[model samples]
Target: MQHLSVARPARAILLGSAGLLLSGCSLFQSSAPQAPLPASATLPDATISYTLTGQGSMPVVFQSDLGDGKDAWDSVLPLAEQQYRVLAYDRPGYGASRKTATPRDPCTIAAQQHAMLAQAGVKPPYVLVGHGMGGLYQYVYARLYPQEVAGLVLLDPTHPDHWRRMQSDAPTSAMAIKARRKLMFTSIETVEFDAQAQCLQHIDLKTPLRMPTMLLVRDKFGIEELGSVETLVRSQEKDWQRMTGAPAIERITGAGHYIQKDNPVIVNEAIKMVVKKK
Candidate 1:
């Protein structure tokens, strides 16, 4: 099923699995000025920018995981924004958004995201698409406001087990730690991480998610000698299948941790399917 392109060893450091490394794609950075947002919605002081496009019955809000902001999704947002009333915003401390006391971890980050969406006048019955760390917030969002999410699309998301196993000396934990250290070193600053880690500490994975969701995992096989990409994908596949309790899963071929960069077509298709379903 992996019928796409682009794969290079990520020298910039990885944050999850050692086998999950990828060639980081740079699109829009937080420093760039975004295109004008839809007039119907406005960017508050807490966010760098919030754009709402599309006029569908249900709204799709895009949230960046690392607080890198909506600019990171420059390539993909317009496509989705045209179809649904899509909303994308930069969380505090990253883009034009104000640096607030809010933490970027699961529980507090989830609450902040929900509150921001509500304040922006974007509400429940939404189709949420999150990538990487954003996947964690999406999970927390769905759990916190189950009634608000209509469909979910997770692109190689981060799971609590991914971190827990890393610290537990499990076969997968070491790689997860390496990935995190690499990523944390490259993207997150020391001060930012202190706040981020504090918020992440309170998240308990015992909460079960019941929303209809699709997890698009990069199927990396033998990309690195540390572990077989096949084994990595299978392990994550089992975890996601159990976590979401959804029988449907898509194995994106020839992709690493960043599936969104590997192939946006898969993500677009998956989101459309979930949103279009009756």
Candidate 2:
């Protein structure tokens, strides 16, 4: 299997304790750190250390962006736990979880995570939440195993189309992608990239996941330049329309690439709505 290589920068939310402030995801930690491990009943690969808070039937499994671990959604968990069972963990190789030698492509990651969830006895009727790169994984997961997934929440996910577009004609743009990849590697380790396998695999959500999908996103790129917020909004608006189609989409104000940290309330509400849906 071809390995995937990606570099994600470390993002942390910094503000006084007044308003709700979500923390950065902890991407790197040695096995020596002695973090709390998942229940022993989980599969060997799923034996990741994570914080599980909340209560409910439809368990919400949150996947963090490149390198980020469970802490990424610290603030939001309190509220989320109040309604649904919130489960977030470090993907293999990043946090306290055991690293894997296999490629970290969408299918591989999704399958492995699914296995882990099963081993841990976290049954489906699940509400999957993914931030940034995590969003991409959840998308693939729903496509691969739609019956298990109940809903999806994507927080400013990186568009696979955008990456492909940059790689084709824009050498300069590709450089930016490369730079981001480098940053991701430095912050975390043992990640793989299979460009061939991951290049927009005909995701027709119209099939299995008739469930609600809430995309709480910020404009990552617009036209040529990073573009103004307006441009980003318009650009995201078009993509959002195409992506969600029948599903509802909400555009939150004042959020950046990391929508969860930007405003936990928005993230919480989006997850709440999707999980609450009958």
Candidate 3:
């Protein structure tokens, strides 16, 4: 899930249910020099920074949460790699990659993922795994290329209705609207927070995913400032389950917003569910 709301620069603006909000995370405004990437972190041209590891017939593509790159999967990758290849990468503005001039809409983001796989010579029928806003992107990919996606695993994914539900859920609608407006230019990646909200409004959700799908939600979705919003959150989770035919969103105990980091067992288990479908 990604966030967009009033400017709370002190900490991440945690309003929208998109789940990109974090307490200590900083919103980067420029393409400042990032720490040197490991030599193994590879990508051709200016496509993106990614690491393709392991050797197997099928590939498990990993898409990280907003403002996060591949490192988010650092702990859980080995388990996934035991059976399949893994391709994890920075979207555009995060990690070692630079922000793209292209609009960060869902359609654009989906095409970018396809292009990245093509550039890497990684073929179709991929087991797509995404966290937070990344989940939305992978969902779009599955929609755009159903035959190519074997399965899907959504870890605390941003519900398609995240923005609209957020504005209505909070005590004041203005709070959530202001949050999106404030961060639009402050963080290069947050640009998509607005882009997604606007574009997703027009995207078709009537078509259900035919592939095996898994939806996992954190025990708590980190936005505590908005009082008594659990019901709203549950509604969002239910919508995801209904749309994608994902199982009920079980509340993962001992898991935070980053469920993959806090509990890799659940994440790997979900991945296994879809991979086994093959």
Tell me model 2's lDDT, rounded to 2 decimals: 0.59
RMSD of 3: 7.9
lDDT of 1 by residue, 119-213 (tens): 77776788888876677677767776788888788877755545444344344545654555556543433233333434544544554466667
In the range 1-278, model 3's lDDT, one tens digit per residue, is: 21111221223345334435542322222223223223222333345877777667888999877767788786677666665777888877878777777888887888888888887788888999988888888988888788899999887788877766666765454374575567553576668877765566556687667788888775554455345455666777888887787645656664556667666656777777788775
Model-by-model lDDT, in order?
Answer: 0.59, 0.59, 0.69
The segments of candidate 1 whose C-alpha lies over 4 angstroms from its true place after superposition are 1-13, 16-48, 170-208, 221-225, 228-233
lDDT (10s digit) by residue, model 2, range 80-163: 776777688877766677665556777777888888777667888788888766777887888778789888888766454544
Q: After superposition, how far is residue 75 of candidate 1 from its true place, in Å?
A: 2.5
Worst 10 residues of 3 by lDDT: 1-10
**lDDT at 252 for candidate 1?**
68
Candidate 2 vs candidate 3, lDDT winner: 3
Give stretches of model 3 more than 4 Å off. Answer: 1-19, 23-46, 171-186, 223-228
TM-score of every prediction relative to native: 0.74, 0.74, 0.80
Pairing residues by index, what is the TM-score of model 1?
Answer: 0.74
